[model samples]
Target: MSQPRTMKSTAKKTTAKKASTAKKTSTGKKTSTAKRTSTAKKTSTAKRTSTAKKATAKRTTASKRAAKQTMASTTGTRATRTQATRAAAVEGAAAVPLPDFLASAGTLTLGQRKLLVDQALLILDQNYVHLPLKAAMHAVNPLQRLRVMRARMERQTAETMEPEWMFHRQMSSIFHSVRDLHTNYLLPVPFAGKIAFLPFMIEKCYDGAGEEHYLITRTVTGYSAPQFGPGAEVTHWNGTPIARAVALNGAQFAGSNDAANLARGLESLTLRPLVIQSPPDEDWVNLTYIGLDGSTQELREQWKVTTNLPPMTDLDAVSETSASMGLDLDSDEKARAKKALYVRDVVELEDGQSSAELKTPAAVGGADLPTTMPGVFRAREAVTPSGTFGHLRIFTFSVQDPVAFRDEFVRLAGLLPQRGLIVDVRDNGGGHIYASEFTLQTLTPRYISPEPVQFISTSLNLRICRRHKDNPAGIDLGPWFDSLDLATETGAAYSAAKPITPEDGANDIGQTYHGPVVLITDARVYSATDIFAAGFADHEIGTILGVDDNTGAGGANVWTHGLLAALLNEPPPPDSTSPYEALPNGANMRVSIRRTLRVGQLSGTPVEDLGIRPHETHKMTQADLLEGNVDLLAKAGSLLAAMPHRSLGVTTSFSGTTLTVTLNVEGIDRVDLYLDNRPISSEDLTGAPLSIDILEVTPGQSLRADGYKAGALVASRRRTV
Candidate 1:
């Protein structure tokens, strides 16, 4: 009863109409009452189910809220723990003590120290991005301190560490064992955008002083083939395709193998390498390769070698066939053929000519016919017996002495019909400076203006000795002046105007010849040739002729002993290493004992790119040489003949003890009044019919006019008073 009262199910009952109850006695009415009782029971059960569903919904909502809070608290705790752990790790790393070995060593070997510093710096760069400012600063402080310490140590011990000794020590360490040297030190050449490596290992040892030391050496015996990355293409000068193979083993170490032997080894490997090809216009291609010592080996191999390429066995036949079929030859083939042909032509001409005929020619048929002679001569063929001039002359300095060139020049000049010369220096290359000086003195005029001409110091060796400690005497006033006089019979103070040294004390002055000279030059003319050109120009000796337009004013300070000295001190890095390898003390010192410049004399000027130009330009053409047209040399001689005589007019006047001569001229600037054919003074005309004190004039007392306009002598006339 209590449960029924408490269960106010709140079910709304449906009421039937009272009027329908009047027929309640029927059968249908009796069934309807029974159904109503069953229906009411079902309705009560449905109401209980609805109430239970509401209660379960409330419990689910409350449980979900509590679970979310619990998860949030757990996640927060985990994050806090992770952060603290990371902080502790960082702090521990920062406080870690330096290794006792590193501290006790005081100073590391140059190579070892550099490697360590470079590795540390690389780590710092990568981690700095994520670290806080304080942490980054803390990391950098130790690295900077180490660098300073190393630098100071290097300076103090540099003198004691000979590069040769260091190299030997390094080599010993590398070959100690193969397994220990598996890790190679890779060096990057940023300029070349290439990478290289050395197989190295460290060994502990004691020095002669019984001091503990470590030696680092390379493992490889001789040389290592450069390992190229994937995506690299191999090509030759002609852009020929090449195939490549990865080395099964790293490069082998062969102690100081010559280039030829190395090439043979590479060929045996069947690596299919391509070599630089020769231009069709050249005799040979100068192939260069990395040597065992990491230096460039240029043309050191006696025979050319290329792997897996079709041999050029039938090249000559192919070229011949192509020529017959009127097909164009390849660039490389054409160059080789052209050079061979040129050499043949030059040899043929040289064999056919005689020395005397090439220099001077006898007037034939009284018509001044073209000279037809042979052999090497300084004079133009038109002025000599030969009507033609040779293209070039090469002296190796082995056969011809330096002093002899000047003596030969003087003798040849006197032999020529007229002093019209073409000094061909196109193939002269270079030799001793003394040789160049000798040649220059012979070509220069006997009389020089008192004004100081420019002098060049091409070598640092000379500059240091002359300008620095070696000679306390002024730089310009040294043995160099005496060297200049070696080619001449005249003393240092000898002059055409007045001989300062008495004739009794000095050798007889050499005969002076006034002539027209032309200097022919090309790019091959370097070093001593350059010095000769400058000296000639300064002294107004001759006109320079060539396509090269500028002189090498900047001197190449190269000494004969430069390479030798470097070897004695540095002894090129062992045959297995590069010359640029760091010393044991970590010092990256480069030796540039020898230096070169385009302009040897002028400091600011660069002549390497700008070549010296000729007064009259002529190119070396196959057609011209074949036709035997020596027009360039002919033109040079004709120019000299066209020049007017030096003497024009000379008149004498007497004023007290003074005697003077007035010279008349039309196209002349100033005249040299030579008393009795001896030059008196340049620009001597002070006044018209001017008088000069007789005491100053030479005793011969013959007045002559030596007038010049531009580069040519206008006229010459003489009178006796």
Candidate 2:
């Protein structure tokens, strides 16, 4: 798919805008809450969510605090009897009882448990890509765990197994231990489409003096908390310190690293996907906070359940590389329920530009972006310490059309400030592989070499590939067949590295923005987002500015069990491999079938547990949260100001069949031209626009120009006539 007509223009002087510094907000907060379960005690313990020991300790803590918060019926400001008595309506929603809701759930028989375990074992042993790496990095080996599970089930005399949630939890924990988000045990029914959340969200930001404070960033609209809202600082969770609570929560379902764990932990404090795991341990929580006006208060809120907002479904769910990076599925639309989930989201950008005018669909950041557009791309004309530039926040790369996505970004980039651009993918949970890699070429002049991926070289994986090689309805596994076959002789743990993102799609859209581009990332950036960041750094597009030390580092192509059942089967006449059986109930799972490897200097290195570290780290400040990221942008702008300014422009004119190529350039010392990917000419710039004439010219031919600085290629341009 070709891109939209490329925007063309000469290098224009960057216009500086007056920097506006809004008052920075810090600490102090409380919030309005949701439906209180009729019996908070009954709902306190979610089956499998908290261990028996933790549950007991939590119950004890609640009992001690039960007296302190006896005035829960009143608002945080100590509401009057009349104010407390005022009625609030909750439409189409129910107050569900807690642990009972899970305890009463259907149970899985011993046979069913075995089936699930066996399926996981086969998938992990034969198809899982990061087995060797994960085995080395993580203390617990999933394969070993599966084997132990199989042993327990095989020898046990009991006909019925634990409750369905327990069984799922055990399996889920096994997958989580690997610390790969792409691979997950998705529960069925009641849980699959449900989300468990609180009415308010919390976040951490550093004050000007570098003190860390946790505050209520936003609350669910119309929840009616007059006592507190944004800017409320949280000091404790239940009876534990807020940071300690976050860490405890993270220990339950954290990702690859400490940063990822803390991030996931913080996100889970407010919202959790029932599809991925059971609800929180407690049906309700008591948040101790300092109100914005210097008043201390305790806000006790109940956990609410909702299905109003569903994650955006994959555009092409049946594709080979499509994935679900856990069920907190993000979407372009800001549905009401989604708002509740993202109130404390790391980045939330609002786009006001019309689809037609922005020529794009976009995404993030807590900033109110001007000249806004939303879909996957949201841009604004930003003013910072270094003047003005475009701030483009990419919420996710999970798009249906890569070409259209790239073109839209190109269009949006052209319309924003041309001086410099800050591309923020903070909290972006990655979507399409092609979509992520395709956009990389647009920001850079260097070749966009999509990250390479490899599968573990095992017999089961080999057999599936061999059997499904000829099945047209299934995936194209022929590319990895030869390499897998050579594994025995070579003794390589993984197959040869190959890019899942086609080279053409990766490089089809050439550089569009000429100014310096900086990428803003956090630990939540995962899967395809990780791939994108790595490519950006590898290609030397610009300096990477990270709010966290590293990204989520979920580097692999994932496949759901359903997709596996369809493609990896060996039907009667040879349909894809049919090894996996019908799982009991509606249970399904996902596995990382191929592990991605870093290119360029880090070539051959796996990106499983280790994500791309930032070239520059930014400690998010209170100004970033309440003042539209002024400090973060200021730091970014400063970096952009110091980088060398470069440009490459080309035009073709013909005189009597001779092609005269005119080039206007800056900063770059040399330029090389290629026709149909073959070298055509080379020139050394002399600070003057140069015209190179070719004796043989075709009506239409592919043309490429490579720009070099300091003996190294820095930028590239492609054209056809």
Candidate 3:
């Protein structure tokens, strides 16, 4: 969403009219007259010319001088034109030619065809001048095409056009390939810098007739690290001595009779040590020696100590390296412990179904009540029949469930005493669009006066060319080479487009409690809330209240790519050897798509960055809420209550999971409540030491304790454990 405030306002009506009329008049008379006069003079001169013998002599003398001048001028003009033409020709030739591969292909697979078309469309849309052919090829591949294309496009369109795009792309590609290798290759390759091949086995397939078995094998490789004791002693593994070694090597595996058998064989030979110690600790060495199986033929072989271990680094060097890797020694240790606990808890949760029951002490009073109203509350002070004034109801939308937004709205509206209403959507974050639409429909009267919304049209360009042996005829490929068509425009245009006007339906306002309505909004209102605001502004059905400021105007929709590179490349600060480390690799992008135009007299005003500006503006601060200042809400309620001949009343009750408060007034209405001059929800009243519904009481007077006890108790009160 564009910031509504920053949007350029349309020219004033008077100025627009003057400019339009002036342009039309200027183009219509003077220009037409000038063109007609020029044509007339040329025709008159041609008619006057004649040929005769006596005039031949005079004509010859004049023709000779004229011919000489004409020849000189023509020669000069020809040379200039030739140079210009050649320059244009050279530019045309220098332009990037169409890809030879695409030109040669008669037909293509679905994937190939989609790739080509998408690439072409993207190029056309972006007008990229220096896209490399190799990069384009990579973008059209089946597995990686979409991801590559999106990345490339984002980089190309970035505001800065930073030179880091190539580097990022290459790094991302390498990381992706490495991840795939890890996932696909099941063989336990040593981290000793050796590339080891492990064979994969496929087992059995089931069919209705019987089970079928198949055998297959695949190899995988990677480098592996070594483990050693603190005293530079080799750890004992099985019966053989464990030596630290690093190498770059590859291997091949033979297929087995059955996939299961092959898998078992591979598992038997593979050695995957969880803890690889550098200069192995004494305890680690002892454990390794004890775990060794002397009976095993493979382990019984003697160990060869051909090469000595490399010299260990100093403590300072190790510390420096660890810091550069972004590891925190203390935090890493804590994280490892937490990970173990987390795994244990997850396992327990998964296995112990009965353990899910955790007993919690219930509270007395209204602590556990489900009748808590979940909607924005406003405070409005109103005068009663007895001349006493207090806070009253103004407007509220009960949004308990996103899907039931419309239903809640309808219920609230029906409960209102008067048809005239004011809806406060300030601070509303977005939810479901359907709910917003439903709310809008309910507010709209049955009868609608037809009006034109706007006009929508699109133009597409088509390219047609024919090659020639010499100079081919080149047509403009840009602009509208095809056709243009008009489509339905919404709002005013819808009414304008219709020819037959039907009799208006009975006004729902009369049937219901239709009265003057106002919509209040602020910057925090977004998404579905914004949509509702837009509808209200467009219909001219109500007055808007509040400042024109929207926080979400600049960011309507966003895209996020998760942490991968940050974890693998840019590790956390204070590097350590611990495997557990915090990784923060969150990135996001946001873009605005649609443009919003307020309707009625405000049609030219945008509600994108600049929020819907209300007819009346009021700013609410945090201090107001904390201190129990109800001035803003009270003002709104007073305005609504002042509407003529309106009876004001409020009904409070428990409705399943929510507390329902129906405040009705003959005209516009407002409601506000405060506890100890501090604002609180109805739910907060249940167990509070002091709570009062200021809306139902006289100004500066608190509700009596008896009234709180008499009200229906929906649930027991909650107390801190």
What's the true lDDT of residue 676 in model 3? 32
lDDT of each: 0.30, 0.67, 0.26
Model 1 lDDT tens row, 1-721 = 0000111112222111111101111000000000111111111011111243343343334334433542354345444534543443233222111121112222444555455434433322221111122233223243354456446546644455444323322322232111111111111211011101111111222223543222221121222222111111122211121111111111231111122122222222211111111101221222222222223223311111111101111111111111011000111121122111212221122221111122233322232222322222223244323333222232211111232334455555555543355666653334333345445544443332211121122222222223322222211123333333332453332111211111211111222334456677653344345545654555566677763343322112112111212222232232342122232332221111111222223432322223344565554332122223244455555545554322234557675546766565444566776665566577744324433344455344666555566755544444555
Q: State each model's C-alpha RMSD to the native.
A: 45.2, 16.4, 35.9
Q: Of models 2 and 3, which has the larger TM-score?
A: 2
Rank list by TM-score: 2, 1, 3
Q: Against the hidden reference, what TM-scores do the models get? A: 0.33, 0.79, 0.28
Candidate 2's residue-wise lDDT over 1-721, tens digit each?
A: 1111222223223111222222231111111222221222211111111243443344335434432342343243333322221211122144354454565566567777788888988888788887777778877688888898889777775545555666777888898888888877877666765566676667788766767778776665445342356666777899799989989888887688999998888878877777776667787787777655555667667776554332334322434334322212321222223432333221122111112112223333444343323545667878887888888887766543444456667877888877789999987777767767878988888777888887789987787667655644435566677889889999988777777766655665478778789899998888888888989988889999999999988888887777666554434554543677877667778788888889989987877789999999988876676667889999999998888777888899878778899989888899999887789899999768999998777867878888898898777777875
| Per-residue lDDT of 128 in model 2 | 86
Poorly placed runs, candidate 1 (over 4 Å): 1-401, 446-511, 547-554, 562-611, 627-631, 634-721
Error of 2 at 152 (Å): 3.6
lDDT of 3 at 496: 18
lDDT rank, highest first? 2, 1, 3
